[model samples]
Target: MPFGKVPVLEIDGKVLNQSTAITRYLSKKAGLAGSDDWESLLIDIAVDNIHDLRQEIASYFYDPNEVTREAKYAPLINETIPFYMDKFEKTVEENNGYFVNGKLSWADLFFVAILSYLNSSVKIDLLEGRPKLRALKEQVLAVPQIKAWVAKRPTDIP
Candidate 1:
């Protein structure tokens, strides 16, 4: 708990903080990180953008006052969501349904992870206007492991 965070991973007796770093480490170990450096770079970019979107949603979650939350939600729904969703839609379209290189990578998994949180927190369908994003979600969900996990995952939101 170097940062007092829950996602700290203990791998080989080495503690790793930061969810993204832990994910990259484990994904690489599982051969789901990326095939090569360039693919990894692409995945990095996509993951960063996805995190940016998540941050916007997190702002809404952490606001203590209704006035502040409502104020934040407007710009989030109007500007931030649209901007990132459009970019992600384009990236998914260019990457052949996957988030990168037409293959399943950590980037796709990251999006799927955040997608659920975003879905439960918001009233609107975040991917309503983004067909490619919808397809990307479907593609990620189709993975047998992910499908099984989600079927039993808790319905809690944060």
Candidate 2:
């Protein structure tokens, strides 16, 4: 409620706001943040990049005017998405299917978690043709904890 946001987390009578801050805090507690400062920095970089791309997609997805939306979609689908996705693909390949430290980090989880929302907004599989990214997604979702959650998560959203 600090920023009137729905994602605020109440912990031990204290409130935490902002999705990134909350995710980072939880990642640290969950052992998914990173192994060290350098690794954490790398994870932060990847997460920030993904967030930037998500904002771009949301801009196009939320536009009210059809004409402007179509105009925005052209460059977004043809250029922006490919540009960011290609970079992500190469990064995942270099890291051996993870976003940072060549192992599971919050960045990987964050990317995989938001991917469905992103795809839904665009109506296309962003991972299509990006084998490394697709594989990363599979790897994250295959985690026992995440898989179990996915099985029970709400399916009402398209």
Candidate 3:
């Protein structure tokens, strides 16, 4: 806290670190949050379960550490990303169109973010063989704000 970066959430002049923790806190404040209960646990599970894999997949595609032919993308394409994506799809369906509940929440936003990542960085035919999941994503995408975001979303990320 003595010599840290900007965007500090000081409580009585105490700085807070950890971006994920801070985002989680803010998600709660906005009601786009989750609970500590069992069912609510899935929300965190779903988000975390996919983040690392998605990041790795993105790095594979866009990171200069990666080459032009998508060599780093093999594992993700052949196994990892699809595996977790399928799990999330099932989780969404099993929970009845939401990640861990019956309403749109942070989990939906998480899914949308991940889908955007997939569309930009990789070729994920999300609905190709998973019609239900595709339809679910489409349904979420149809919402006005999110839809506008998607329409104006940037495809070029370096």
Candidate 4:
């Protein structure tokens, strides 16, 4: 596999690595990218920002040293999470419960998809008090295709 990764996707005998690249390609084909170039740009911005936040969470959660891990937790919970979540909540609220263009895009699906992993890493409900974010989660999960997929997808991972 290219990059020796599990997420590599092979289509028409061509291999694609990296989750973001694969997701973007599928999103475009699935009509979830955006309505136009500008909207797609906005979706890309949101997805990139989400990726940055995920990197921060992963850095703290994956550190093997207990003391350093403990040290990172406080700032992550107190500052990092709220800083990002608040902006995300506001964006969702402004966009009428979607990440961009007031409609469902790959960005919304991306955030909702990784939320459980984020919560598991942090050991807390990241959307606990954020109503808009909670609504956004509900909105995405309520999609018939996503709902069916969630019901049938393997639950082996936490």
Local distance difference test, each candidate: 0.85, 0.93, 0.69, 0.94
lDDT of 1 by residue, 70-112 (tens): 8888888889889989988988898889888988899988898
lDDT of 4 by residue, 1-158 (tens): 87787799999999889989899999999999988999999999999999999999999999999999999999999999999999999999999988898999999999999999999999989998899999999999999999999899889854
Candidate 2 has what TM-score?
0.96
Candidate 2 wrong stretches, greater than 4 Å: none
What TM-score against the true fold does each predicted structure earn? 0.88, 0.96, 0.68, 0.97
By TM-score, the best candidate is 4
**How well does model 2 score by local distance difference test?**
0.93
Superior candidate under TM-score, 2 versus 4: 4
Per-residue error at 77 for model 3, in Å? 1.3
Q: Candidate 2 or 3, higher lDDT?
A: 2
Candidates 3 and 4 compared: the better one by TM-score is: 4
As for lDDT, the candidate ahead, 1 or 4, is 4
**Candidate ranking (lDDT, best to worst):** 4, 2, 1, 3
For each candidate in turn, give its C-alpha RMSD to the true structure in angstroms.
2.0, 1.1, 4.3, 0.9
| lDDT tens per residue, model 2, 5-120 | 77999999998899999999999999999889999999999999999999999999999999999999989999999999999999999998899868999999999989989999
